[model samples]
Target: MELEEIRVAVLRIEGTNCEDETVKAFRSLGVYAEAVHLKQFYSDMIKDEEQRSLFDFHCIVFPGGFSAGDYVRAGAIFSARVKSVLKRDLEEFIREGYPVLGICNGFQVLAELGALPGFDEDKPLADKPEMALGINESNRFECRPTFLRHENDGKCVFTKKIEKGKIVMFPVAHAEGRVIFPRGREEDYLERLKENDQIVFRYVDERGNYAGYPWNPNGSIYNIAGICNVKGNVFGLMPHPERVFWRYQHPNWLENPESPGDGRAVFESVIEYLRKF
Candidate 1:
């Protein structure tokens, strides 16, 4: 598909403050992208022409922010809404091999929707959530720069442009970002993630070494910062990639200004995948 022919939907709801930046990230790549209200997908209150279908876009993104104010868990409300109305469509979209990217609060939604750790290939959506992004171990909302080491071994479409073991910095802002699997199955789940090559990114220090606390930020198991599904088409992470689409967005860019930011490679990778599809 042509770059301009590929359309991206940056799905959002009230309190999803990062949609604009998400849209900018894709548009900067010269692809068609827009911030789409969640209601426009299944709400009768919307105008007929305003309604959209999941199949309308080649790729869909769940951007960062406190969706539905993160009232019931970070993404519970939004996930519930999507499950209630658009679950089947979303499942179909995933089954069709279309790309789905989620960031921060968006990552919570995918987990809540049972869309990640998609161990069951036959079932598009897990019967229940297999993991949760809990409150940070610090017990407070953390907002700071974070370094991540790309770990995916060519299975994740989102990180294809990112060299394995390469360290990249993306800022994170969230309270509920710690990733936890079900009790008694943590080891089993982690093993499965590694075996399936689903672990895409791991938190690291400036020197690219695995570290703890502020480096891990949310205390995600195994220092995991991001992951993709078994098929590599669905991806979710805790960092805000859209916020750093350009070198100027980096906190220290003035000292070492560059055109493309570390995060830009993510968008470029996905867009390149869509072009081949």
Candidate 2:
């Protein structure tokens, strides 16, 4: 991987931070990625007639943070602003099968934007999304490194390069990290997503068992850490994979030689997906 070969842009807005480490993660992987303030892009679009749109980027990243100070919810205000400004371009980008990833707070935005597990890509954005990442059943924000197992093979261009049952360590820090499908239809929703192979990632014990609270930190339905749109182009996850991108970011890296690159898989997965295009 080299800067000249890979191109990505970290999307940031007022009150939404954490793009710096995200840029470093991609750059470290030899991907020439940079943090682009959403306001700057919006301003450029308004000031320069010849300027290309934000959709020009290969991949767009919505990092984690308190966007709009989590007003109305974790990402409600931010998602609304994005919809108002970049709605058309964003839709076109998704339609073209380009990748868009939202991590933690970003995931909340995507869910609010009707982009994750996106049911109808052709339909206009809805007032309320059918699915949501609700408050954790635990009723507390748990900030700790946890492992997620890749459970499905078909969904998510990001997970296509990862091995089934592969355990990747990442941090989960959110008061509301639970994945909720519409009411009473829990089993049906899980069965449908599973059959479609859309259950992209899930919490799992070291031996791959779906047991223990340490593994299933927030009690997300089916221990889900993430999922993708039907087209596998739009991905969203509650855990902050982007947070642990460096070796030192892991608490026990130096003490454990067997510690493989936990956070690297995510960036690598995105790169591999883009290479196919």
Each model's number of backbone clashes?
0, 1
Lowest lDDT block of 10, candidate 2: 44-53
If scored against the real structure, what TM-score would every candidate get?
0.98, 0.90
lDDT of 1 by residue, 1-70 (tens): 9998999999988889899989988998899999999899988999998899988899999989999999
* Each model's lDDT: 0.92, 0.79
The reply for model 1, stretches above 4 Å from the true place, is none
Work out how many backbone clashes candidate 2 has: 1
TM-score of 2: 0.90
Instruction: Count residue pairs with overlapping backbones in model 1.
Output: 0
